[model samples]
Target: MGKKSKKGQSRGGNSQKKTGQKAGSGGNKKKSTAAAAAKAAKAAVAKNTPPPSPEKAPVVPEAVKEEAQNGAVAEPVPAVEPAEDSKPTADDSGLSEGVEASLVLFTESQQTLIKNLCSPPSNQAHLFDHWRKPSGVVSPSSEATNNVKRKFVAQLESMDASYPDGGLVGYISNAKTLLANSKSGVNPLEGWKPSVPTGQMFDKIDEEFEKVEKVGLNEVTSCGFVLVAGGLGERLGYGDIKIGLPTEMATETSYIQFYIETILAYQSKGDKKLPLCIMTSGDTNDRTVKLLKENNYFGMDEDQITIVQQGSGVPALEDNDAHIALDPHDRYKILSKPHGHGDIHALLYSKGVAKKWLGDGIKWMIFFQDTNGLAFHTLPLALGVSVKFDLAMNSIAVPRKAKQAIGGITRLENEKGEQRTINVEYNQLDPLLRSSGFPNGDVNDEKTGFSPFPGNINQLLFKLEPYSAALEKTKGIMPEFVNPKYKDAEKTVFKKPTRLECMMQDFPTVLEGEEAKKVGFTSIASDLCFSPVKNATKDGVALQKNGTHPGVAASGEADQYAAVRKIMQSIGCDITDAKPATYSGITIVPGPEIVLKPSFVSCPADYKVKFPNPSSIKISARSSLVINGSGVVIESLDLDGALVIDCEEGASGVISDLVVKNDGWKKVRDGSRDNEIIRMRGYHLD
Candidate 1:
């Protein structure tokens, strides 16, 4: 991709005042660079009518009226009904002048860089030069629109492996299609060109990554890292702070701790202790702060770690039947809603983090959630992968045979019929996806399916400069979402949390091979990246309570057991004499029949055992059961004293009556439940 003008410098201002405006008042006076993006989205929906032929429309829509009130437009908008007071205020005039002034800061070289940033990659190369030469002007007549679309298709049809000019001409064709279809009531082709205009500053960053030195600990020393830890533990019953829940074999270890260690380790390798930032939600920020401070930043430098408060914008729920917004307070009294992690891009852009990091010499920005600790490897390894592939990489996991969870990579064709990347969940998986070599198996067991899912871990690595460049180049390319938007008005009338997934993948595609190189993406093996502390069962809880973990196990224990049993028979051990051996707390038990190898016994260990690994012994309870040092004992008295356990856990299990005597509660906490054989907060007792 060619370079563009250097219009990528950061602009600082009050975000709220600049992003919205009142009806007929035009857009906000103080516009951020992101505001001038194409309105093709809304235009795409209004493709039927011919576009207004003027450079700017005389009559704006009711939507624009509302948009004006919110100050959402990037260009200076004239008042619909000019009033004496409607004249541009000094601040308004200054903002308009300021934007144009700022654009001028970019040199010719910079504008070229910006254009490259917006160009698509070679593999899926097809350009839309709406920012430069739009199609509506070339073909104001309906026949011209048809001709333009046909010509664009013809160009794609002529493509070979090595696309001509890396699909540069295809881009110009796309812009034409957009203009022909655009009904923004404004002529989209005014002053259009096959490329970005000169003297109009445009900042450009390569979408593709280039190897800096092999990333080392030294690089970590100077970088500042922050994790988005804003989600509540609602899915897990919200009994405790999700961030504080023990996720490591040692009770002291947690998801956040692992994340912290990984980043700190990278920094340490560089011999530069880096600063770590954690964005916590309002509900858990206090406890999170205390825990971090008490632990002295969990083995990292105290000053190197900082906790910041995340967003509190909860989308209002709506009643489907009444078609009215509902109060979230009606459900949970203490629900501290967040605007979702997608807010990171906007927040960072507006909050000046991008500039701050740039000044601080941070070259790349890696973002991840605090749930999965599997891909929480140090930045060196992740950065190495990113640079190696020249991609804005995302760490993914191969889907289970047919596991049905949300979210997966999607491949779609744009108007140019060029392959593009889209990330959506299983629900949104298009019909084309099923035929696209995705895994497919039994519906019940998604793991058995034929789909090969790149399970997104929400881990991303991006060249910070390139990301900023892309933002500058495609400024205001995104739509202002009405957040917390729910689908089913009855069940989920909450603010539709419109995911900014488009931007994450879209930006990379926009910069591929030109301003950027390519967007690299692949899946990491489960063993290498599989530590997720899902608070779902007794076993998971028990594993965290005990000190035994399976982090370093090379092979499955069941396989080990099978091997040992065969060896025992070869050694003439008496298999008939074998009986259940009770062991606990990191104890190694040799089979009475002299098995070749001894199996290690861990009580809570089973709780945190890695998924898909089979356990030797399994135990489960329907009503209630007691787990003690003697091993799990059934206490159902309804079996006529003949112990007969009905439930099963892990692979298979059946246990019968044993000497079970207990009043149930083992602890004396005043708030704890009593007289219950099995105690779990959210489980239903029947």
Candidate 2:
């Protein structure tokens, strides 16, 4: 094992490479079984691969060198036939002395892999066409280039042996198609017609769904939850993993804690421990893991949690030619960005988490994004709708006005009669509508009072078996689109680098025809189901007047408080709706602040069982009530100040006609507050 480990550490076992040798003459032939898997395959490898300069010869081993050679040399997708024009010499530097300096860094088999990965028939060929040379080229150039020589050489040495060939090829193929479409002035939806889908509205979900929620409640044991928390909190002015930020000002619980506790709350009602899979990216993985370890998985059983880090980022492209982009400040590095949250699906599939869930009797997969604050509040009914309709996919939606920044779920039919139900990004929907016969484009519906197309919240649920099977067929790769901001009308240069991006919501874009019908949506009231802390404090304020949503920490905390207050008001409690107020220059949503545990009221019908209230519950202005236990009973309550009742899981508390008149935790504008949520809300305790 040690020998193999050392062998793996060396560059594809092509160590101690003594140079000054001629090409095409095999001075040292380190044979890879994969490159020489068969007569025809060896021919392919030899045709694409450059020869080695070492003295060793005829060194063919019996074991296939998959880790070193992969399928780069022997296989062909043949989207286009390999030709001389498709070779790396498209940059005219393939034969440069500097190229040879970079080439000998890898074993001959590894070189063969690199060549095939960038050459013709391989769709990534164009990426090498515009670069001064392929990624590893180290030629005599500018002073800056010389300074980064060692770094570039290291990049060449560490070339991925396990890079996903299929995904890279698909990406290049998509880019080429998009480039052509742009040049020809063709639209992706050229022959397609878009229409609004009357998805099942939970607001009006037949009174029969009270039974549906129960059925969903029963199915909780067979479900696994996924949290897509790959992003960082940089946009929110925090320096940690986004999930590590406090969700609300009251409990200061991290978003991950809220999710885990919510799952645990439902787990209590079921017989099994439902597994949780969190998808993180390179940016957040270490911090996220440390957070989980420090909190002991946030009360989750160690065995019940799985963290899957996202695959290596997709390469950013510089222009329509799809040349791989280099880091602007450091040319030695490839500029790679998150492949987008859509990678969560691919990660789950690649890690075999989805398959294991299925074998573990988990029949549903609930996928939600980070720090929404209302996903768990809305998940139960959505899951029920999935089970109720036997849907392969369910996108949680909220009422949307036309042209809102949020993507809208729409059903589309192509000229060929093939159909799909997917989220049409706001930018695309208006034009699609104009082209599809609506002259006004994206106007409100007279009957629905809003756009018939509901806004996509990016929270989705999938039936496990079909979901897993579909992913298996595609190897978990979603449809990817690249949007390059061309610096020219000819579309030859990019103003900035761009990469292919895919959305988790776009997962259903893969299903079509009758399979597409199996994909639908569930529209819930936005106030009750969607309050995401995604924007910065300032950006939220800009969108506050838009009536769509502010989507920041201030709005998120305020939304949490408002949600609970409405629940209380619905149950005959005189929960006063406070007028819109300001907290450190940001508009606080109008409502009383009421924060409670997930167990405080599982549903509106659940409060009666917990409190068994008789009458007289009034929470007035300048006051907030926070409840943190399922065992807490509230008979009659009147509060004019912050009244916090915190109880442990096994503990109980009873507050009868309790009243508080003193000053509560004031919303003092403390810029030095360590708590990010409170800091962003511009407040902290005295």
Candidate 3:
């Protein structure tokens, strides 16, 4: 169970004194004034002087004491330790007997810190009033516990200062309670319903797309984009930044370049520059920033892009023991880990970016993960939906195939008996319930059927005002999940406390029950709009052996590359043979030698004018056709292996049976190879 606060208790203010004065008789005006003046003077003094050392107790002003005696406030009292013969009671400070026993393991220094932090006389006690006692047993000797406690105390102190509202501490404590409860072997998905977005509303997506495009053009200035790119390309077998990896495009552009191009294309439709915010983690921040600088911000104004780094959190001990050594050199120190994408909300608020967005008349923010390529074109449509429906939170979901192994968006009654929408991760659902068709079960609503449970793809459009207001109301308290991970590559032991994480998608739950109506989920075409590059290679055998679904065999990079090629082809680009062509048992490679400029076929509408009679041209995928100038010609040619056709202004070529394996062919002024061909396979170029 979570911690509970006393009814009518107020925080961070003099509400207690105000309540007491209101209850007092009207005759003590002079005394009340004196007390108020004294309190003000003490506050002023405390502001000027440095904070008292943690080694000593804080000093209370005599004025405060007088006010307490006069019923204006309650006197501070230290928590009493139960007698040796007495049994622990539930009403005792949130700490349980087991947790108290575990604290005995901490060193004296750690004990002092914990005591000061939780004691009634301490200023921080109120911040931790909601902490529930640990339910699990934790036994450690004084020395061992002391070492662990020291590190924990230091981490807590730092977090307290960093997040004064107690979000970090509250989240950690809540995570501990959740982990303990989950160990009972009960299904976490009990009573929960899983459903996806229904696409029955909009008749034509193209019409909706056009409507959204118009709205986006009108509100481009008042909108912003946030890209969550905090992760490295380690999972994709790339040691450096993932966004910088080259894609299989005609120009061999990187992921970041494609994203930038898309953004530029969208901006070109309007006059105002849209702000692009990139949320990066510590590992990827520097490299990402450097790459952007080197590329000249990808043709976008540097001022329009803002990069913010998310904060990190301390990793918990595997045994929940305070004395365990996190490292060989330092028994008390623990490793730090990223606090999950959920921290984006707090980080944006803390950095004042959220406030700035609100002030800038930015009504909506389009947030998408960095690993996606389709996200570039999907933003305007998402924003349009938010505008059309006047929604506070709108998420874009894609259809989930059977056993897709992704989280699904569902509507269910929360603990308060109010209907709400949530993202139910794959692992959170019970296998029996999942296999039985879940929300589509007989228990589903008679009026609303569940044939589609659209999977969440992390593409969201949030109304700035309501979203920010909701965040403030929740005080950034996000649901934390414990992700058990190995402490080392050997996987011998799991890290303690597990990894506490939160998700930004869960922010919709923070809104009041009534506001739930303003939140919605919209379905999108997965092929056209959802392609996440999570892994480098598709290990079908490994995935099947582990009982997990092996999604598309094609890599994310390959999928994106293919999508781009398909779009270009649809635009009537005479590049049907742009793909690698096999000849004589050898596969020829493309790119660097064969390139397609974005200006040639910017969109499908430009196809007819760019390439008239597209069937007349034969451009092999592996062949290199460099059209630096115009008037390029395409004729019958038996092309095989790598072939280079450089056409200048007013140049044309007519070749036949061109077999240039391990060789190169340069088009001369007369539209013919200088000497039939220049074979340089395995030979140096001069």
Candidate 4:
């Protein structure tokens, strides 16, 4: 049995040898079959997929490359360790190390953008440090947060970098520092005294009126009126432009219309066209431009007007110094706020408006706010004062009434022994010092007998050359003040955060030695020129009721409107005192819809000669009329409502004959009524 098993094993061994030789010989055939299968699969894939362009080739990761070389299947790659400085190297993201680091807080899409667009490096990361943990609470990392960070960083890096050597970055940094260290809470009455323009000085001003008038007229051609119309009418509960708010006039004229008409009237008195510069914030710029264009620039040449967009700032975070997010849900959009009036100088310089003014031979500039109806009324006189004194800057002030909550004009002797004119804000004054009979606290100049410092109306006349020089000298840096304001006025009961703002009138504080000496102050009647329309209900309604008295209705639109009417009536523009329309025992005098023609009166002295006996004309409270030009005859005309008469300069006509009687009303009437409401326009009697 052993011999048989050995033989069988030997036979099996011989069979195995023979099988191996056959397998070796046929190995090429098996390999060919495998190759054919692989080739077919490859061809199928090639037919279905398009070849990638060199520019759009896919980037294979390093891990995959190592796996391919080692003949092993690629495994999921582990996250690469960030560089020691937490910067991304070119090998990591194909972006500069700094840019990668700046984008660390950004999302994958943002990282891809940094990789592709090659954006410049910025200190945005540092700026965003405050936003990282708002209210000292770390928010979960999200796309929304990343997007917000990206936008804020972009804005910071993209600001106008054209400011001489300091650039926008330096300006922002310096401004932030100054605001952080500002003396806002200090008492201003420590070294304060009253200073005012005297009656003698006014007499002197009047004495030089003719010469000043001539000089002012000549200078008007070289002067640009800068209207700081940057504020939104939100505080007034108005969505439309504040300057476009209607004033009580026969034609329902707007403040802008009145302003333009006044400017045009002054322009008509001379051959030189006065240039008007409007400084508008982002919120108001477009609306202002549209309003002017729609009205054909109010008959003034478009070239005579220059509209400049002022810079805006973002609201700071409540808990941190970073900017506030526009949307809390997304936290991506940073909300922007209007920079204070102090931005005027920087805006003028940065926006090329100053350069344009200089090129146009504009030697002087008057910057005033738009809320005041009489803002530009005495600009000629103010310009005259500036020209007469050869002053670098002339500030127009009005006497501060007892307990008036307005800043007062003050003169301070600085450390350098230079007397600098400064505005003592009401908040900065001690309550005891602000009280009447406070010794040496009020601005009382004994020499001029002009006691108590006059309140500033923000009417400034700047000698363009020196003003430009001063702005350049300081790199257009202005002191910033922290103003507490609500983030959402409707929802939030508490103040959202403090806003940083600069006051344009604070220019004198930045000046030194000789520059301070160039600053001067002049006084004007507050009732005539300083009435500001601040609040909607308070201003519009109160002014309509109370007139221009100092204690009128907390200083609002109504007071300003009342002041304008009184000023007009004081002149010979006959505003007939018809009984105010009454409904439910409430006397309703027309608020903003009243309009008076500019040709009728430009000032208290320039009354239209056509209306020689203005008091002889009668008007009803329900009537809206425009009396243009001379030779108009009125014969007991009863105007119930809505009438316009365009009297030609030489054409003589009677109001009764000019009336276009409504035949339908006449036929329907009982004929017993002698008076009826009439709606007529451009009618002439034969």
- Tell how far residue 562 is off in model 2, in angstroms: 0.6
With a 3 Å backbone cut-off (N, CA, C), the pairs that clash in candidate 2 are none
Residues 1-686, candidate 1, lDDT per residue (tens digit)? 11111112111111111222112323342232123213423353455534333234332223334444565554433322222221122222222221222223344643343334233321111122111112223212322223333333333233211122123233233323332233222332222111101100001111111122233223444555657776655444334466764332111245567566556545533544555557676677887888788877767877655565644443222222112122232210112123345545544554456566766677777666666544443344445555555554334334433334545544344344343343444554533343443334213324434344444556666666777666555441332222234455343343442211113333444553343334444444343344443443334335535642322111111122223333222223222222322122111122211111001111111222211112222222111221211122222222111111222222232233323322221111111332111122211111
Off by over 4 Å in 1: 1-224, 234-238, 249-251, 306-308, 317-338, 378-381, 400-403, 411-413, 417-420, 434-453, 471-517, 538-686
Candidate 4's error at 435, in angstroms?
Answer: 14
TM-score of 4: 0.62
Off by over 4 Å in 3: 1-172, 185-221, 320-325, 414-417, 427-451, 483-497, 538-554, 568-686
Query: For model 2, how does the per-residue alpha-carbon lDDT over 110-213 read when each residue is reduced to its tens digit?
Result: 45544655566443443323223233332222222333444443443333421233545556566677666665677676777988763577554335545666
> Which candidate's TM-score is highest?
2
Candidate of highest lDDT: 2
lDDT per model vs. reference? 0.36, 0.68, 0.51, 0.52
Which candidate order results from sorting by lDDT in descending order?
A: 2, 4, 3, 1
Per-model TM against the reference? 0.43, 0.79, 0.60, 0.62
Q: Who is ahead in lDDT, 3 or 4?
A: 4
Which structure is stronger by TM-score: 2 or 4? 2
- Collision count of model 1: 80
